[model samples]
Target: MTFFYNLWYSNSLQYKLISLMLYPFSLLWIIIDKLKFLMTKPYTSHLKIICVGNINVGGTGKTPISIFIFKILKKMGHNPIFLTSGYKGKISKPCIANNDVILFGDEAIILKNIGPTVVSKNKLEGVKYIENLNSKRKIYDIIVMDDGLQNYSIGKDLCFLTVDRKSLFGNEFCLPSGPLRQSLNSCKKNINKIILTGNRNFKKNHNILKKDILNSYIKVDKVSVKKKYLAFSGLGNNVKFFDTLKSANYNIALTKEFEDHHNYKENEIADLIKLANENNLKLITTEKDIVKIPKKYHLKINCLKMKIEFDKQDLISLKSLLKNKLND
Candidate 1:
């Protein structure tokens, strides 16, 4: 996956030839993806389901935005629970967040900390699990799917397609050919609005369907550390996290990138600590990445906590849409 991701972005002649060779496979991927959508009848739930997903394979502010929605729903006096496939996690049955519960997925751990969370391989089964709990306890009023825009097995009442304006649809190709999980046109019909998670102002004149652009960015807390520090993360866009630090004038001594949702080992943690001490640098990483680290080593590292915020009017518009949909 990392090799293909790098090749998809490379401009060298060899990479282009490789991409061309993989183009046929990408077409096959698109056909199979489309057929899956055509063949599957989405499972509908009685509760309102809002999905925050992206066309790009990697992170584009989905976690933060989903958390934002979860908080908003809480404020609105409605209970909301997160339902996810528990990517890369061994969650065969529905499980909720608890200190004693072991969360196998990086994103799942983070989401669990925010509110009630359920992890299951099947989205429909996850929803049903939560609904069953509600029947016994009346614990939740809504369900939020963190990243299932491409998964058509679960019907959604609202959908927000997130995009990083700078890297939207890299090379305009799919899968091994490029970064897109699905073709741009195929995703447009499912997206109710586009959330641009960058500084570039999205203009209506931009070449795409006319849709509302939610101007926002991942709002990180200000760090007080003044010394040079080593920044590292296992994120889809590790560079983006580093770039965010650079934008904030952080004294980045060095940076390292790892595959998204990377599981950390004791040896790797020790290595990072050793490297940081050798360079007299503090080790820092993203909140999402930090959660996966063992607690005993947490004091050895720092994390940049972030949240997503939309403009006032834009947020109001979003809430209005949600309210209208739920009322239906």
Candidate 2:
């Protein structure tokens, strides 16, 4: 994708054809999406559901936002359930989210730390799991769904669509030509809230994000000064991740970059260990990456966590909306 992304951006002709082909489907998708929206009709959850989704295909920090929502819901004294499509995991039968990265992927694994989670491609199945649960042990008071924006099956009490600052709208085209899973226009009308992740000014002037959805950068409170560790992440952009560590005041000893969702091999792990030792650094990775790492190395793993600072007005409005959503 990285290699092709460059080629697609550079060649307008290539980009145009791809877009043209998708254009018909994109149009059809809009109609289908609208019909689905109108026909399916959003169902009210007995327990509240907040979904963190986005227009982009990936890398909008949806997972982080999902985790934050889970925490917020629990802090309010409501049990929360996380729902995901289980992108690459195996478990055909719907199941509760577990803390096994290998089994449920890193995102869902981190989510479980906050509350109960369920991974199922069948959205209704996940919802039904909760509806049919013991009325006594009603494990979840609410649900936080990760990446369920276009999914019409399970209705959300609230929806926050995430946007990557750097690649806000890849080539301004839809899938196969660009990174968007749906049109940017689709997000604005459907989403209850829009969250812009990364540096404060990530996608400053895209007409879509810049106008009103931007949120300030969540500043780093403290960081290790003298001795630092080598932090490597394979999320969206490696440079930005490195910059974030630096901004947080960590003097990174060494940084290694890799493709998104890369599977770390034994030899590669050994190389990282050697590099860290040679440079006198510890290994720090993102929660997403750490999950792929075998448990034998779990003790050696460290991940950085971030805070989301919503605007004062937005925050107040959101809190109120959520309270009502959860109550109703």
Candidate 3:
């Protein structure tokens, strides 16, 4: 899957041929996506809805950005509840998310730790659930949709599209042909703002205006530089995790990458432990990936905590913008 994902961004002749062959399917996908938006009437809730989403198919740091917004809202004295589709989770109906990775997936569990999070397959159902829950005591003042920009069934008060600076828009084509979930033009029209995440020095190349774009970077917690570590993760962008570790000056002995949201088997974990032990290195991974591992092994592995840090001016503007929107 990673190989194909890389191919999507490749500009080689083979990629061009493959993209051409898949272009028809991409067109069909776009047509169906647009039709869904046209057919469905979005549900509007009294509670303010802020969506953190992306045009790309893979992760664009949506979870972190959503968490950041949730924290901001919390500090501003508003209760914010997360609403997510629980992408790989088994349970389909709307319910409060829990730490069971098999039932709610990693992202849902992570969001649940920060505040109240509802996991639902149908986002509309999730919004309705939040609305009903708030009616009694008004506990949740806002609903933050983790990744639902393409979800046309719920009206959003403010929508933020997260874009990784490293991989802006793979091949600049829609799915099957490239990484984009929707056309860039459609994204600009739907999103209230674009949150660019990654290296702060990365230049802007998209069509969105500079004023509409907010810059942010992942800030990793300090790790012991003396110890050699074996880093691994099953994130949408594993390279980004590895890059973050390198930037933090961690002495990585070896690194391994897995498919996004991979279900780690006991043997896999055992193998990793053996390899790390053999190389005299500590096992380290992202916070999102650590939840799936058995609790017994938790003490053996180190989790790299990360947070999104926005530019100073951008942070001020975002806070003000959010306050104004909530007041409205």
Best by TM-score: 3
| Candidate 2 displacement at residue 162 in angstroms | 1.1
Ranking by lDDT: 3, 1, 2
Give per-residue CA lDDT, model 1, range 1-328, as digits (tens). Answer: 5676667666778888888888998999899889999999998888889999988878787888888889988888889999877777766787775542245487787888998888887878888988899787777889999999998988999999887765666677888788888888788888898877853233322436467877776566666557788999998887778877876667898998888888888899999999999999999998877877889999999887666777788889878877787788
- Candidate rank order under TM-score: 3, 1, 2
List the candidates' TM-scores in order.
0.92, 0.82, 0.95
The model with the greater lDDT, 1 or 2, is 1
Candidates' lDDT values, in order?
A: 0.81, 0.71, 0.87
lDDT of 3 by residue, 69-176 (tens): 999999999989999988789987999987889999989999999999999999999999988997777788899999989999888899998988878887878988
Question: Candidate 1, residue 289: CA error in Å?
Answer: 1.8
The local lDDT score (0 to 100) that residue 118 gets in candidate 1 is: 89
Whichever of 1 and 3 has more lDDT, that candidate is: 3
Candidate that scores best on lDDT: 3
Clashes of each: 0, 1, 0
Which stretches of candidate 1 lie above 4 Å from their native place? 1-3, 10-14, 99-102, 199-209, 223-226
Better of 1 and 2 by TM-score: 1
How many Å off is the CA of 253 in candidate 3? 2.7
